[model samples]
Target: MTQLETAMAILMKVFDTYAAGEGKPDTLTKGEAKTLLEKELPGLLKAAKNQEEVDKMLKGLDFNGDSEVDFSEFVVLVAALTCACHNRCVKK
Candidate 1:
């Protein structure tokens, strides 16, 4: 696989691994999302201004107001973070 292909595969794998924790295999419940962030992206959590900021960020992930994040929504989060980081690095 190419570099981008490997990244895409890992994204799906990470989402699947967390989304499988409870409720449904296709979506992540609030708890599962939190655990995924806490475990998979601890630095993001730490960079938040506070717990409420972290909570607000997670709450904003639900675009359909379903309270659960689907794969597409999760991808948005990853893509946004990737853009933010890439821009930050390029600025320096």
Candidate 2:
């Protein structure tokens, strides 16, 4: 599978862990995913004060400008956030 697909799989795993079996994986609606990102991923998306901003932030990361950021975009942004966090830790 492609890198984006891999990232989507990983994202699914993350969500599954968060939801704690309260919901089905296939039935994970966009709002639920958005909620996860907005509430849980504050470090990765600092300016995401709300779900719409979170959605726009994700959209902005779409390098191909296809109006859809798949797993690749998601993973790359997460990786960048991870690196940034690590660097900050080192600096401190």
Candidate 3:
């Protein structure tokens, strides 16, 4: 597979792995989302300054107000982060 294809597969795998933790098998509950962020995106959590900031970030990821994050919402989070990282890299 191409690099982008591999990345997409990895994203789906990561979401599936975490979303399977509890509740629905497709969407991420709050707890599952927290675990996924803490484990998979520890740097993001660390950069959050405080619990409130982290909470806000999570809330923002729940685009549909469903109290859970579906795959499309998760992709938005990843894409935003990727853009942020890319911009930082370009600056350097």
Candidate 4:
């Protein structure tokens, strides 16, 4: 597969793995989401100045106000982070 295709697959797989942890298999409960954050995106949590900031990040992910993160919400987080990193690197 192409690089983009591989990335897409990985994203779906990561979301699926975490979402299956609790509650519905198609969406992530807050606890499951937190676990995914801590494990899959440890650097992001480390970069956060404190737990408040991390909480805010997680809150921001639930765009639909449904108290859970679906695949689209997860993808938005990934895309936003990708853009932020790319912009920072390009500015260097």
Distance from true location, Cα of 23 in model 3, Å: 0.7
Q: In model 4, how large is the Cα lDDT of residue 92?
A: 39
lDDT of 2 by residue, 1-92 (tens): 89989977877677565444335443323454455566678565576577677677655666777554444555676788789879989954
Which regions of candidate 2 fall more than 4 Å away from where they truly are? 1-12, 15-33, 43-56
| Candidate 3 segments exceeding 4 Å error | none
lDDT, candidate 1, 1-92, per-residue tens: 99999999999999999999899999999899999999999999988989899889889998999999999999999999999989989955
Q: Against the hidden reference, what TM-scores do the models get?
A: 0.94, 0.51, 0.95, 0.94
Output the number of the lDDT-best candidate. Answer: 3
Q: What is the lDDT of residue 82 in candidate 4?
A: 94
Model 2, residue 39: distance off in Å is 4.1
- Identify the superior model by TM-score, candidate 2 or candidate 3: 3
Over the stretch 1-92, how does candidate 3's per-residue lDDT look in tens digits? 99999999999999999999999999999999999999999999988889999899899899999999999999999999999999989953
Candidate order by lDDT, highest to lowest?
Answer: 3, 1, 4, 2
**How many Å off is the CA of 49 in candidate 4?**
1.7
**Arrange candidates by TM-score, highest first: which order?**
3, 1, 4, 2
lDDT by residue (6-79, candidate 4, tens digit) is: 99999999999999988999999888989999998899899899998988888889999999999999999999
